[model samples]
Target chain A: MPQVTLTVNGKSHTVEVEGRTLLVELLREKLGLTGTHVGCDTSQCGACTVHLNGTSVKSCTTLALQADGGVVTTIEGLAAADGTLHPMQEAFREHHALQCGFCTPGMVMSAVDLVNSNPQGLSESDIRHGLEGNLCRCTGYHNIVKAVAAAWPVMHGKETVAAE
Target chain B: MYDFAYEKPTALAAAVASLAGDMDAKALAGGQTFIPVLKQRLNKPTTVVDLAALGLVGITVTADSVTIGAMTTHGEVALSAAVQKAIPALANLASMIGDWQVRHRGTIGGSLANNDPSACYPSAVLALGATIVTDRRSIAADDYFQGMFTTALEQGEIITKVIFPIPQKAAYQKFRNPASRYAMVGVFVAKTAAGVRVAVTGAAQGGVFRHAAFEAALSANFSPDAIAGIATSADDLNSDIHASAEYRAHLIGVMAKRAVAGT
Candidate 1:
């Protein structure tokens, strides 16, 4: 077994894992951070999307040993200590972006990274294209696209949400 | 996926040695493609050599060429200002790969090494006449790719970098298969100092290949109209569930023209 250390969601943990153990498995099975779902088990589904060292990657394809000593931010790490949702999460909720909510975690995780990387502001098509890896079986992506647009303004501190 | 021992070698030599010492070992790059193969139990290596710690991620640009490190991710390439300025078409092609998540982890060297028949990078390499620098030697792009999911790379030979000559004008056009998004018929056309080169992927059975007729036509005159009258033969093209060989051949013509017009 390979002993891997990960700083996940701002917490550090050293655990033993098999060489074939995936990063998503480490997060969900070992650390109990089940917010990162394994929708397809393959890399195609973005349900296992997470931030590895400030960039979004599909955790299902990332090996545990490959991510050793790296910092990871999962869907669980997005909110504040007081339980305030991230602007993307808030927008998803406010605009009714999700229906079954199965894809929300990865969708929101990928969306935040998209907004963070593109400070110039994302258009509707950009959001749709940006979220191509994340498949939402419900809501038809209309509201999800709307939520990403609405959140970008607030995320960049150009506009305030929740009457801030 | 079968359980295997993993080694992350900090030095390139050590990484190569680790792989060389074991016949059942395989080198792992970003593993965007390999992992999926492993999940399906398609490949079962006894040992996996992790290449992340070898410090093989960077992009360098000169007046004529851009050299990208082997471990450089597609996300990094797509975002690189130098790459964007030097070869915007290459950057654009990288941006259109698998997806945002895949781009973050998929490496150019990995894609080239795997040499999947329908992969996008090989078309660029073939069209641009790039050089694949290995741990031991530099191989020309023309001689690097052999066939589907195959390359000239030896068992333990690692790709250190890829050197691509910046083209005067270049563009890639891909008709994506709606579901897998793999290129149904992708064409990359480049007008370099040497001459015009057109490489087509996804449609060919023998992997990416240069379109000599289009190249000759476009070299005489660089425009969609120049290659409009020419037709590609469907004899050696791939025909699977997604597209027929005839359809792929037709798409090659349309895509080649589009690539020329865009460039």
Candidate 2:
């Protein structure tokens, strides 16, 4: 077994896990951060997407041992310290970007990462292409694209999350 | 998950040494493929040597070629100025690989080493005549890919970098699977200083293979209309739920024509 210490959601967590333990399992089981869902064990689905050291990665395809000493931010940690919803989360809710909410956590995480990287704003095609890894059986991607654009001004501090 | 020893070696020699003592030891690169296989319990090694700490991430462009380290992530390659300037077709191919998360973690060396039949990297590697450098020896792209999920790598060997000769003109066209986004019918066409090389992925019976017929036609005329009359036999192409061998065969021509047009 390997011992891994990672900073998740602004908290440092140390756990002893098997070498084969996936990072998603470590986040959900060990740290009790169950916001990151595992839909497909294969890497095809981005349901377990999270930010690793400021970049997005699929937790299911990453071993916990590989995340040792790295910084991981899951969906649970995207909120404010006092439990305020992030702009992306609020945009999803306002835009009705979800159906069953199965892929919300990952969708929001990827969207945030996308808007964070593309400060100049992304087109609908860019958003769709950026979130291609993330699958949503519901919504047909119409609302997801809206939600990303809705979150842009809020993310860039150009418009208020509440105003949007 | 199985219990095993984990060692993150910062040096290539040290990483190889960790694998030397244990026959069941595995080298971990991008973890895009291995972690999923491990989660499915397809592979349970006693030791996993993580190469992320070995400092093998970079893209170096020279006057004649570009060498990408084994650990360079797909995202890094896609966004690399050197790669874009040296070979935009290669950069475009890298950009189309998987989605955002997979691209952030998947490495060129890992994909080439894994030798996935539907992967996009092998097409570029073979089309551009890249050289695969391993810890033990260097193998040319022609000799690297052997079969499905197989390569020239021996047991415990690790890929260090891949050196690709800058082609005179090249382009890759892929008909991706809707759900998985893997290439259903991908064709890479390159006109190098030596000659024109055409490599097709995702439709091969074994793995990525060179299309001699397409190459012969392109050699005669390096134009899109030149490859329009060429026929690709369906006998050796793949057949499954995504596409039939006949459909894949049909796509080979369409994709080859687009590739020739540099689309």
Model 1 lDDT per residue over A67-134, tens place:
99999999899999999999999999999999998889999999999999999879889999999989
i-RMS of candidate 2: 1.3
Give lDDT: candidate 1, residue B211: 95
lDDT of 2 by residue, B184-217 (tens): 9899999987788999999987899998988988
What's the count of clashing pairs in each model shown?
0, 0
Model 1 alpha-carbon drift over 4 Å, by segment: A162-164
Which candidate ranks first by DockQ, i.e. highest? 1
Q: For candidate 2, give the docking quality class from DockQ.
A: high
B37-136: candidate 1 lDDT, tens digit per residue: 9999999999999899899999999999999999999989999999999999999899988899999999999999998888899999999999999999
Identify the runs in model 2 with alpha carbons over 4 angstroms from their true place.
A162-164
Question: DockQ of candidates 1 onward, in order?
Answer: 0.87, 0.81
Highest-scoring model, TM-score:
1
Categorize the docking of model 1.
high
